[model samples]
Target chain A: MPKHILRLIILFVIVIGLFLVARQFLIPESFGEYGHYRANSIEENANHDIKYVDRAECAECHDDIAALKQGGPHKNINCQTCHGPGNLHIEDPTPENIVKETEREFCGRCHNKNAARAKLIKQIDINEHNIESKCIECHNPHEPWN
Target chain B: MELNKKNKKTRRDFLKLSSAIAGSVAFYSMFKPIESVANRKTDVTEREHWYGFGFDIEKCIGCGLCAKACKIENDVPREPFFFRTWVEQYTIKNGHIIKDENVIVESPNGGIDGFTQSVPDKEIFKSFFVPKTCNHCYKAPCVQVCPVGATFETPDGVVLVDDSYCVGCGYCIQACPYGARYLHPEKKTADKCTFCYHRLKKGLAPACVDVCPTGARMYGDLDDKEGPLVQFIKNHTCRVLKPHLNTKPKLFYNALNEEVR
Candidate 1:
């Protein structure tokens, strides 16, 4: 109701707006690039949890898996998808192992969906695209992406 | 100007001084010509050296192994953009040079795979595997047209991008007629076949050459006369990927019958 109070409220709003606007400019681009932004991610319990692992570390003892990677469509797929958590595997190197799937169907967690572009991998095809068999039917999981 | 008689030195003395200066200069230069050292080993000879690739068109099956192997080796960026290498399976089917594009494939379905084709033994097709790689042209248009000097030809003749230098102008993208280059999204650089220089330097074969069930994709030093490529050149007549671009593509396709062009 008073002009002085109205001016003070407008100034408060501007300060809040500036803080929000400058958030991106202050934050590093790579800050959130790697992880799942959703609230349900595995690491959400921690105050600061950013988890990721490049594939080479997985190939260490999983030479069979690595060799299989050489033979599969998932050769290019980042191993973290089906391998579950990676930082723990890197630290322990033994207990958190790859939960191998029955067939090539295991490779489809991220690949199963159509992406931003028209689907490069129609992994959903066995059910949706009308392909006769699962992924391995025409593919060799150890040597797939070409 | 005032004329000088006694103030000037004798012409004979000046000639003697000039001759002595000229003789010393000649003697000093004769002993050292540019101070060249023993020939240094080139980066091309090092692990980064570029090896030229050529193909035998007659033997190509259109199996798409070259395209596929590149995707595996590089983890090619996906979709609406077929990458790296693709097979142009040419055939005289239905009385036409039926060109089939067996490009890079991501396989939930195994649609298209590589630059070399791997037709099954039981199947019937008038096709062969013609493996393709970056042509590594001497005067690569991709290199010359880059607005940011991102794409550059190496001393070894392989045209490469200094991804750091790339501004994502996409000029090199348009300049390439062969469709050899693409804009890498994460890095925002122009990416293309490096001819697997990293492996070649280790004395290992390119991934496609390694995976080819048939020994279709081969790499060797084109400059070396004793190299397998020169030996093959001497033994058989082959064709370069595109002669008209005048890029002088090192990749050669062999065994192309006149019928399949």
Candidate 2:
């Protein structure tokens, strides 16, 4: 190929490549809206594995509290994130997953991260907060905004 | 028989022509977009899905019912910064800024009762409410400027964001001249009032439609003859928010007592 022709071909390819790479920066993720509002991927639990019921599932008995949670922000998040999942608790809503102290541990799992780069946040002194405070103190696990 | 010199062209001639083309290209790149924006017009020109809402400035009592209900339905954050929808209360006296109805804040519920006391100095003081929400412009600037198609007008004409798709870069947020869109804090996605599309799918009205204490906020198809908007337009000499821009916002404000001149 001629020298000028070869150089022209290389320049065209470079410009087109630039457009392609810049495109990724232009588009945002598609799965952000109504994210956890839909459903979570669940795996089967062994019979011995204990679980706590979803807030909505538990509403069959605790209607008042569940009703209040409906208006709160964290309404879509699974109960397991706070109380733990209820795959094994189909028969019983109460278990170690439903413990009163689980709130501190669950939030601590993320907030207690050593790095400041954490996007999600829940700040409570596990020792001090757990002694008296809990996750519900600032946020309702069932409803983050509430 | 005249021997013609080879056809001659000077370098200056070529340079001037090239410079003119380059200058035109440079100038065109800057102001051409304005013309393109003009010719592009808005999707509302088709009179299709521009969801124009009207708030009677006089009828609005400043009650924040719309905001509160929207927050619950869409889970909008109530913190100091982000706002999907808002209201601007204006009280104009002879086109003068009277009553300082400027809330300049994003509140779902403007906290006004939509009723004002009888002002004795009616000329000096008259109060009115104007609730602002996503205009759902036919040519949605948010959608156009969105680096991602995260914000788009649905086929039905209501503008919506596929939160699942939004990257929360806030390009749409900044592009909106009307400042309707915002990035959610936790979900980290762009969000705005959807006109409660989830309800519309069920053949029910939007949450704001259901909760507005007064019929201040109204929604209807601008194209349908049987739609209230058609009749509303026929009866009322209404004004659209910033119609000069020709965004063709579906949201129309009825009896907009005072719009920026």
Candidate 3:
């Protein structure tokens, strides 16, 4: 009824109208497509090239080594775990790219005596346990401690 | 008398106008956040993935390869304190009365390098490495407490943070019971392990899973009943960390030590 009241009502209506118009543009296209998030995120995450190749791929070529590793202490260990990522090597086999791990320090990374390690786990002090010989000389990584 | 009547009419109009403006302001303020809720986007999809993590305590040799791999993969700071994932070595002695014996828990440099024995050989009774990461709880406190919708759980059951959206309020960091989250030093946003969400989506095992010399850590789809993770969970006596909190952590630990928190 009042002039000022009419103006206020008109202003409020305008604000609401603007909000309704803007909201459509503000929200993402894929929002709420999957749960409460953007659906395209799935496709985005899947875009990266995989770096690590699993054991199944290694078994394709190295069946002998795979057979030796199975049922052994190191059965659970993947070939790439020690040899390093094989995606490049799988594409092109090369001694320079995919070589057997020969360094004693590589083995020492896990087997070296450490107080934090479980007591039952066989650990070498190196100084006390065959310091003269390399780990692979006495222990075959495929069937270690055999 | 006529002029006074006109003045009264103007005053009434002014009161009504002021009230209307006040009402509009209040209404706008109330609905603004709700509208933002509709706009708020999480970097997640409705994909059917039931991601789960399994840790083998007995298998862990405290070699820290998992931590190292996780750090390198996630670009976590190489510093000891800023760990996206870490391994804690727990050593306990004294059999029956465990409290009577010495119990030591140490994770030097987040166990990035293999740990050196702190206690002597004979003195120690039992020790094992517990690999730690974001539990990605079904009912995550971090998701609940985030001021913004920055941190959220994906349909695959992976909990992740949208660094772009995070306000760096640190609520998620504090809410995480497992201490999985930290305010990233440079990014200033809450950062935690996404179970290598990027890696998972790419059809590869997580970096930690790939690098673990011993099969101490495992990740797989929980929905796949025939999968190794489901089989492992079914076969083994598995326990999650801090079950009492009721976070419903997806990370299952086999042979979890009593001393481990």
Candidate 4:
């Protein structure tokens, strides 16, 4: 072979070698193990701390309130939906940690009259629906219809 | 010169023979039946689990508890614009479902604050609330458009984003037809629902489904033939969002209004 051809072959090999070495460093170890993404990411995405506890967890301790809620219109509603996340309260069992929303505005979030709301949901004009007293005073949140 | 000519002819003949063999091999392989990516079976363990989601529009009361639960569960931004899930109220006037002007859609605070009537009762021909989230499509456009391989579909049929790998390109955000993806303001990476993958792994339902007071939402493994999700799909005439796009979305809706897009 000519000297120039030998030099070109050496240069080509060096370029290919550099690319192979670079790929080892640049590409992630787990890439293409499952698909195109990093395999470890699946575990990472699945490892977040569960902020919302199941209703069964609340029922474990508050069986009385759970029993009251069971027969109500809001039977299907999770306790944490209104009280906020109960994970912290589950650990401490403190009344201060869990919210006790009694304000009309809090009730108005769902109960206030809205045309977009489904006809099945009980809605009322917050202004005219017994304005003087809180919702819990007249309508028991546990069994509102009763 | 005689020897040189013979050597050249032999080399040319070898090249031709090798080329013919290569061509024949390529031609044979082309005709051979190969399993497509869609039909390819995953591992037995992975095949045993395939998640699906559905909701009943008739049952949804626009309570917004699902929206609130998702935000708190995922630690999504509190701003009205940012949402992993949201509820949209569609109001149609004069029963003109086809006309764009006849329909009015609103989702104030992503319907975390309960919806109020916008269209008058007299003009309103029909109206309903639609809770929207990532569909986790089988052929997801977001996964296809991601400049980096940060977004991918798992073997068990859940689409997920690798936060650490994302380059914050926003390509996937724009590509998603359902408007499910959003750029995380703090992380600068594209973020969306994971179908609550963490909770699902722990055998818990997605946060939105967990908080649905009216039992509007349903979720279960499709691999379980007796699962509620599969049963719901079997019993109800379910429809997906933008079926023409061919995303093959896993999210199904029953009693979905034709006006809803």
Candidate 5:
């Protein structure tokens, strides 16, 4: 064969070989192992400390509150909605860590008057709907009507 | 005579060498697409569940409970601008008198706080809240545009970001028509709703669905013919956002108004 053609063949082989070698190193160790993404990503995402303990977790200890909340308007609301995430409180069992938001403004988040809201759903103007007292004073958070 | 024979031999050898090179290049080119096909055919027997989501506009009360739950559940940034899921309030007041007049759509702070009315009650004819989230498109432009394959869809139809591999080019964010993605200022990677993948893996509902006061949102296996989601789709008139784009979004909206765009 011609010397130039032989040399060109040698160069092509070397370049392609380098690309194959680089691909081995460049690609992630777990790439395309599970799905289109790296397999480790599933584990990485799972590793995040779960902050919101579902209502069942709260029911384990606070069954009285759970019973009260059942079938009520706020039954759908998770326990952590008013009280903060219960993970720390569940782990430590401390009053300070688990919040008790009895403030009127806290209740006003959903209850406050908004013209955009549906007429059928209950809402209130905090100023008119008992401005002098906290929401808990008139209504129990667990079973508000009672 | 020997010199002539030598010249012919060399010419024949050169032809063989050139043909060999062309054959090798052609073989390599042929395998390129096949390799991608092999990548796509990775084992998917483990993920039996295929998820799809639905929203009932009639049920949503613009309370923003879902948005708040998502932020806390996903550890999204506390900034008002960031949201994995949000609610948009569409108010059409005196809509009959005027064309698209007194129509207001707003999601202040991603509706983290419940929406307040901008137009007066007297002028308003009708209003409804439309919750928005990542559609998890089957032909997701975000996944297609990712330079590093950082954004990808799982076997079970969830679009997720491999944060470890992401180069944060912001291409995926721009590719999304529904504006579902945003760059996390702290993580420096594109962030959006995973449909709460972590929670789903743990056999829990997405945070938004978990805290929905009115059962306005539903998530379930689309493959399950008997599932409530499929039944709901069959019974109710549903539409996806921006069907004209042909993204094949999985988020189905019931009672979606034309003005929602």
Candidate 6:
């Protein structure tokens, strides 16, 4: 072989060897264990804390309220939907940890007159319907119709 | 002269043989059955879990509780533009034929606050709410476009992004046909719904499904033949968003109108 060609071949081999060595250090240990991603990432993502408690957990303690809600249109709504996340409250069992929204705007979120809202959902113009009073006073949140 | 000629002939033959051998080796390597690193590691037939999601458009009440619950559960950005999930209100104007111009779609605050009807009742012919989220496609464009291999699909068929590995080049965000991925403002990485994989791992429903005021949203294992998701699909003519895109979206919608995108 020509002297120049031999030198070129030697340089190419060294460059390729350096690249392979650098790749070993740069690439994650679990990079190819699963698909193209790092396998440990799956476990890291699954380790997130559970923030929202199931409704069945609430019903265990508040069966009376659950029974009241079951007989009404709100039966399908989860207790935590309006009350907010109850994971902490479930552990501590404190009334202050959970919300009890009684404001008209809170109820109006779903019920207030909106053209886009489903017709099946009974909507009212908040300003026109029983002005200057909370919705819970006239309409029970657990059983609004009754 | 004869000896010199014979030596030249031998040299030419050696060159030809060497060239032929090198060419064959290159051709063989090109067609070799090398294992694809991108393909799922698990055997599809033996997969213990393959999750799917479905929703009934008729059952959705436009209350936006599901949208609210998703934000609170997932810690998605409070900004209107950065949502892991959202609700869009579609209104078809009265006396107007269904067309791109006639249909009005709006999602204010990603419907975290309930929607207010923009189109007057007299002018509106029909309206419905469509809750949107990551479709978790079987052939995900986001996963395919992630140059760093940061985004991938799990064995259970949920697409997720590894924030640590992401360079945040925004290729995956742009590649998504469903407009599902968003760049996280704080993390500066591509973020989207994981199908609530963390919650799913703990044997719980996704936050949106958990808080739906009407039984509009549902989640179940596609592997389970008797699962509610399978039964619902069998019973109803469920449609996926942008079926022609060939994304193979796991999110199914029942009573999906022709007007919805």
lDDT of 2 by residue, A35-78 (tens): 21111101100111222222356577667767676777545433
Candidate 5 stretches greater than 4 Å from native: A2-8, A34-36, B1-39, B42-46, B95-98
Write down the lDDT of every candidate, Cα atoms only: 0.55, 0.56, 0.80, 0.87, 0.84, 0.87
Candidate 3's docking class is acceptable
Off by over 4 Å in 6: A1-13, A114-116, B1-31, B37-40
- Evaluate model 3: give its lDDT: 0.80
Q: What lDDT does candidate 3 reach at residue A60?
A: 91
- Clashes per candidate (backbone, < 3 Å): 37, 35, 1, 0, 0, 0
By TM-score, rank the candidates, best first: 4, 6, 5, 3, 2, 1
How far in Å is the alpha carbon of B23 misplaced in model 6? 5.1
Worst-scoring 10-residue span by lDDT in model 6 chain A? A110-119
DockQ of each: 0.02, 0.03, 0.35, 0.67, 0.50, 0.66
Q: What tens-digit string does per-residue lDDT give for candidate 3 at A1-146?
A: 78999999999999999999998887666756654545555455445455556568989988998999995788877776677667688889787777487766667668788765555567778657776777888789999976
* lDDT tens digits by residue: candidate 1, B10-86: 99989999999999999978765543222322434453334577565544334454555566556666563657776
lDDT of 6 at B240: 96
Model 6, range B1-261, lDDT digits (tens) per residue?
986775565777989999999999998777664535335468778678999999988877777888888888889888888888888988888775646777889999988888777887798888888988999999988998889999999888889999999999999999998888899999999999989889999999999999887788999988888999999998999999999999999999998989887
Clashes of 1: 37
2 against 4, candidate with superior lDDT: 4
Structure candidate 6, residue pairs in collision: none
Q: Least accurate stretch of 10 residues (summed lDDT) in model 3 chain A?
A: A42-51
Q: Which numbered prediction scores highest in DockQ against the true structure?
A: 4
